[model samples]
Target chain A: MRYVLFLYAAIAFVVLAAGSIILPDWAMFLFAMALAKGLVCLGIVAMMRGGVVSFGQGLYYCIGAYTATLAANMWGLSDIFLLTLLSSAVCLIVGVIFGPMLATYRGIFFAMLTLALSMVLYGTLSKMSVLGGSDGLNIAPPTFLGWAPEGRDLQTALYIYVVAIVVIAGTLMRIYFDSEQGLITLATRDNELRVEYLGASVRKVMAYNYIFAAVLGGLGGTIAVLALGHVDPEFAFWTTSGEFVFVAILAGYMSVPAVFVAAIILEVVRSFSNLYFPNTWQLSLGIFLLIVIVTLPNGLGSLLSRRKGGKT
Target chain B: MSAGVLEVRDVQKTFGAVTAAKDISVSVPKGAIYSLIGSNGAGKTTFVNMVTGYIKPDSGEINFGSRNIAGLAPRLITRLGIHRSFQIAQLCNELTVEENMLLAGAIHHDERPSFFRHAHSAAARERAMATLERFHIAEHRNRLIPELSGGVKKLLDIAMAMAGETQVMLLDEPTSGVAADEKFPIMDLVIEALRAEGVTVIFVEHDMDIVTRYSERVLAFYDGQIIADDTPDEVLLDEKVQRYVTGGPA
Candidate 1:
């Protein structure tokens, strides 16, 4: 049954890659950006499974973008794969440093601490004149294993690359959620005392989850920077983190695929509202969120889960 | 006495002005079933908490086997072979009964839980099912905790606690919320299961009937101290136990 899910994911990946050839350049870029942001939301979903909602995920997101951009600019490393690897490694180390401390907190304290950390990053980045300061830095177009695709080809290459990464990440996350450690996390969410009495360390579980979320956030930032061609302090800003939280809540933690789907829906709504309403796009998004929350309290994932007549 | 499996010596615990445990000490013989009887705030739960590492005694030596387990974290104590159940059944309300048992089995059986191994692997499922069957709750294995009857929840809670390698099992009011008719049946099932595994059973109770029926020995508590420690019949006849604990004729 698990392998069957992976097979379906592979098929979806192939279709998305093949179908990208017919999409216009602008549409491809938009979708790539949406998927990149979806990766960040995936990190939030991982932590959510352990009963934590990080409000400062943008801290890792911004760090990843800056890591990739700085490595490319200073070291002249232009390969997308190498840049992503570097960003993930850096984020992993940072996560180790912070995860233990963050793991000690829960509920509003955890939320506020994460938010504070991201805001600190935003503030620090804004004052650093060497790394473009408040205006941020622009990244050079990426090459794929020495093959530099140009014009519309570049957009398609990036779209396909993002699609591949999402498939791999999503599949691994699904497996993780089914693992023994994963079930322990879900148990911790329900009764931490019982989990402790059962001889599993709740703190250790929470710490490991925090580290995983950080790596996912970093991966998302790397992809976003590659597609957007820009990295700025705003990536670590409160509003940026808020948007990721919005996607997480909208997707629900039950399904991995629902996360990206929710992200795409948000992007589409934002794009259309920006184009048509121009000034009231935020209000439009607010109303859309209200509708989703009222109609589906468990988020879009519950709709499919309910049809199957089982909890995921 | 057969070698004591759990030995508590001069344990002291004070919560602000109230003395919860004052120089209390007891040695539980291996494989013996002991019942603790006390009124509310009489420090019955406090003693359990101290032994299980939920509340560290102000000063004491809690020796389980050869190790002093006092002041240790609950998880560490649990891993060291002392497991416990709550007065109110502690269970994952969102997960099914089998899943809860599977989680406990996975954690206890493996040196450490695997990140990639499926939680409901064939081996884990088999173990979970066996434990459930032993407790006579196999029929409700797929039902969620909230959906189970109070008696079933209590049974499942005790079953989960028994999932690990336990030398000593502390059951805090195991039959508290259970129906009167169901209490004896539940106690019989629990004591039989624990006895079959050679686990030392220490349970707290207000039900004198249950105390006399299931336990070979009884400890009566009053004002944070043990007033009577003897066979069930002898403890029931003590003057202090009569006035302070069971409210029976002295």
Candidate 2:
């Protein structure tokens, strides 16, 4: 069953990569950015499955972008792969340090505490002048093993790279969802007491999950900075985190591929609305969310899953 | 006191003005079937909670094989070979019976509980299947938990607990939601299953029939203390126990 999903993903990404050559620069850039945001949404889905909805996911997102920017500027580290790895390393370290506090909380307390943490980052970043303050940092063009693609080539390479990363990460996360550690999230959400009695620490399970979410969110931020060639304090803003949560709700936590699909659809809708409706993009997004909630309560993936005759 | 496998040394707990447990003490011998009986608000559940590490006594000792586990975390105590089921059949409602059982088996894995290892390994699958069959729920393995009846859920709850290496099995009202006719059969099967594995059974039960029939010893609780600890016949016939716990003629 997982093999089929992987095969479908490989085929889909291959088609997308091939299509990137013919696709307009703007279209490719937009899609790549959407996939980057999908990584953040995927992390949110992981936390959501564990019965936690972090409204402050932007905290790690900003940390990744800022870390990549700082490393590139201070040390001349411009490898895209290294930047991505650095984002994960930084977020993981932060997660381990803060996870104990966050994992000890649940429900609204968990959500609000996450939001508060992200807001603290936002405040700190906005006030710090050396780190670019409110205007944020400009990233140097990233090199791929000493080969830096220029202009259109850069866009094309980035599009393909982002797609490949999302596909690989999605597949790995899907395997995790099927594994024991993954199923324990459902148990943790269902009955924390029962999971404890079963010889698993609920807080530790949640703490590890929080760290995973942080790493994924940080990875997304790194990719986003690479795509845009800039980073800002706004990345840690509450509304930015809210947008990721919005996409997670639109995607549903049931399937891994659903996260990417949701992110792409959201980006398409937002861009198209910004082009057509001008001032009503938020309104359009709100309407889209309402429709999804009222019609497909489990999100668009449930619709696709039902059509394929698979479990939702 | 040291002779028993599980011993409680004057455990005490208080919630503000109300005292849930106060200087309570008891010892459970190895492989012994003991029933705890009391009226509502009699501190029976609180006692069970403390024994299982869900509640920490204010000032007392909980010795499981000479290890003082009074303030230990519930999972640590669980790892110490003590397992329990909830009174309300707490389960992963969205998952299939097989998945839930496999989760229990996976946690018991000796690989230091890693995500890198396959959760549904061949060994874990074999153990889950074997246990499911033993509990007579193999046919419902693929079925989601919400589809199962109350009795089956209760049975599966206990079955999931037994998936690990348990020395002491704490069942909180195992037959509460079960039908009257199915209650005895469920208890009989559960007690038999646990005893077959040489597990010491300590269950909280409100039903007199289940207590008098299945348990060799009974602990009667009243006003946050153990009023009687003796054979079922003697405890049930005790005048104070009958008046306070069983609501007999004062």
Candidate No. with top lDDT: 1
B47-89 per-residue lDDT for model 2 (tens digits)? 8899888898999999999899998988899899988988999
The DockQ leader among the candidates is 1
Candidate 2: residue A282 lDDT (0-100): 90
Clashing pairs in 1: none
What TM-score does chain B get in every candidate?
0.98, 0.96
- Give the per-residue lDDT of model 2 (tens digit) for A82-197: 99999899999999999888998999999999999999999999999999999999998898878998999898888888888888888888778767888788678877887888
Q: Per-residue lDDT for A249 in model 1?
A: 89
Q: How close to the true structure is residue B126 of candidate 2, measured as C-alpha lDDT?
A: 88
For residues A15-129, write the lDDT of model 1, one tens digit per residue.
8898687888878888898888999999898888889999999999999999999999999999999999999999999999999999999999999999999999999999999
* CAPRI-style docking class of model 1 based on DockQ: medium
Q: What is the lDDT of residue A228 in candidate 2?
A: 94
- Those runs of model 1 whose alpha carbons end farther than 4 Å from true positions after fitting are A306-312
lDDT of 1 at A221: 97
